[model samples]
Target: MSFIRLATPLRSAVPRTAYRRLSTQTTPEKKSNNTALYFLGAGIAGISGYIYLTGSATAKVKATNTESPLDPKSFKDFKLKEIIPYNHNTARFVFELPNNEAALLPVASCLVVRSPEDLPEDDPRALKDSKGKPVIRPYTPVSQPDEPGVLTLLVKKYDNGVASKYIHELKVGDKLAFKGPLPKYLYKANEFEEVALIGGGSGITPLYQILTHALPDPANKTKFTLIFANLTEEDILLREEFDDLKKKYSDKFDVVYALDKPKEDWKGETGHLTGEVLKKYLAKPELGEKVKVFICGPPGQVNAIAGKKDGYQQGPLGGILKELGYKEDQVYKF
Candidate 1:
């Protein structure tokens, strides 16, 4: 297997001196002029600082205009109050929004939960559905961390999927306790000029968070390209929201749908995500050199795109990426 090195974090540059003494043997007049120049420089620095502060405050207000009142820090103590089904197999769990002063969560973070024991084996909130079937699973939140009163988790049902089945059976007014504000993968805004998101099945949850967070900020200047693959066109979730984001942020966001089994009239890309196909939609290897890749999905799909071999290994993504000469550190798996 080929090995790739992770990139080290970029270091901040040292500040440069504003002024330097010219010839220590300068005359008295020259010394006086130098002192005057120093004060002038100080004045300019003060003005610049004030302008920066004012602009920063204005920007914060604009960004926080629709911000959530629920604090993320207090997410650990929040309780689940409702579960709304999104499909036959998927549901959105709603938590009783926290009321703490510092409960706001950072964008791209997730809430963690430890399921309770001692509930009836057949209980809907337990690890089983109404039919006493086993169910229950872990998932990331789809809603913004700051939103007040309600946190939604989009869960897809699978055959013998314990978590999903239990969630589907939950009714309004029921309490399902959970702990979180648990950290998840986050891409710092403007850290890179471009980003590529590769997702399969429900892996799109985190990708959606990143895309939505990036699309609204004009200052971010980070472009995004998404490669979403699923079993079939009907299996693709969040179709409406993805469409809206594409339309609203047309200049900065691009999405390509790849279905394993597409209908006759389907016009978009199709088939499994192969090296050749990824190369076609992605920027060249050189462009990928500076780009960060986020991969999430079934272990096989994630492993394939991330360049893993012999099941899931610790090494860097292997296949086409290594062949294309992309660096290992550029890829992050979730």
Candidate 2:
């Protein structure tokens, strides 16, 4: 949001007297001095030109180096920089970027990650899966798209979950192969009057990505309502960040946390998110295209809410959202 303005350099001017002296001088000594002066001037001009060209080339190299580290077409290995524990099962993993640069990820996109052991045959020690393929999974980063120097992923360890377990076990200096900027639905300001984000567990991340990208824009007029379901209060990921957003963008954003098993002092809803619960908070289906619903979570939760995703494609509408009269186009599964 800030810009640096470079001041223009002042051009040096030659004295009229110096030109007159050169024109009037007839002595060989004066002519020789003038010739020496001309040579000196040429040398200075050559040095200046060389410096300018070198500086321009340096600037171009710097620009190229600052480009986003993740490539959409190929997998690149990024070394782990730091890890911060979030809860009993979840942690935030930070990976170093080669140069100081932002992730520059598009809004609502994710990266595909796989273990280094799953890399190509060039590595003699590479491990092969029993299924004869690498275990790859897509994950949305909780960090902002423009966060520089590193990209961070909020991961939760799931029992027998290959990708999650691998991420959880990563040490600070280890590396992971990542490929993406995998495009999802790119949101524009005021594209919809209302957006209902329904998610469970780590599913809140993509929803978080959307809201963070949207609400911060001065032109954003859309209202967002998030219904996040978790096992308990402790299971809610990015709770503080969402709460801060609600406080800062009160008119444009709000969130409802649903805990399956809440503590005695908890005041939020305590039950699995159901169709009835959704109906109460979501925009009326009659609003049609003005309203949009996004669903992401564990397979069961997503299926119960808006039907299962058929691999990379969205499956048929068959769940609570369908019963509630939400059309296929009005809902998206991530």
Each model's TM-score, in the order given? 0.68, 0.78
Per-residue lDDT value at 200 in model 1: 97
Per-candidate RMSD vs. true structure? 18.8, 11.3
Off by over 4 Å in 2: 1-66, 117-132
**Which lDDT value does model 2 have at 162?**
72
Give lDDT: candidate 2, residue 170.
82
Local accuracy by lDDT, each model: 0.67, 0.83
Clashes of each: 13, 0
lDDT of 1 by residue, 41-135 (tens): 65556556766978742443222324344334442334567777666556677766644223355656665443444455555445545476544
Per-residue error for 164 in candidate 2, Å, reads 1.1
